[model samples]
Target: MDAMQMALPIVGIVAAAAVTFYAVSFAEIREKSFEDLEDKDFESGGFKPSFSSRQRRARRKADKEGRK
Candidate 1:
């Protein structure tokens, strides 16, 4: 077989795999959206920040006792 003919199928397989990966990723994100809406962490006013976003936790600097 010609080199071009052999290469074309390989390219097509890679393209198909990429399309499938994206489709599954989007589906999982959509499912997570519904779960987030049902979460109990929301504040009375609005959604609460995730644990990692809290003021104390998000601070990167050392505390007064630890500072030089």
Candidate 2:
């Protein structure tokens, strides 16, 4: 019974901490405004191509050369 009393508080503290962590993690935050970006930034793709897209392009080029 003494051990149970000690363990109960420890478990409650851990559970409270986990709940707080998740609540903070998933809380809604404001989206950043893009007004600071220059025209050139928009002209280029806002983000870099993913690895899969780059690999697909390389494969297509290779297939075209193979056909030639």
Candidate 3:
């Protein structure tokens, strides 16, 4: 019984911390979702080709042209 009395507060504290963590996580996700929604105002919908991929494609195109 004495242990239970001491443990209840600890359990409550941990539960409250978990709830706060989840609430903040959810809020961040929601904020990011809204930010992405706003980002769709761009032409490509927030998609951009990586620099290395573009460089590789350009190199391949040049090689093909040189072979021709």
The best candidate by TM-score is 3
Q: Order the numbered candidates by lDDT, best leading.
A: 3, 1, 2
Per-residue accuracy of model 2 over 1-68 as CA lDDT, tens digit each: 69999999999999999999887766632112333333236446774535698899999999999999
Name the candidate, 2 or 3, with the larger TM-score value: 3
Reference-based lDDT, residue 22, model 3: 100
The sequence of per-residue lDDT tens digits that candidate 1 reaches over residues 1-68 is 89999999999999999999999999999999978777756667656655464656546444644675
Per-residue lDDT of 62 in model 3: 97
- Poorest lDDT segment (10 consecutive residues) of candidate 2: 28-37
lDDT of each: 0.80, 0.72, 0.89
For each candidate in turn, the TM-score is: 0.57, 0.40, 0.59
Give per-residue lDDT, candidate 2, residue 9.
Answer: 99
Candidate 3 lDDT over 15-68, as tens digits, reads 999999999999999999988877775566565545698899999999999999
RMSD of 3: 5.2
TM-score of 2: 0.40
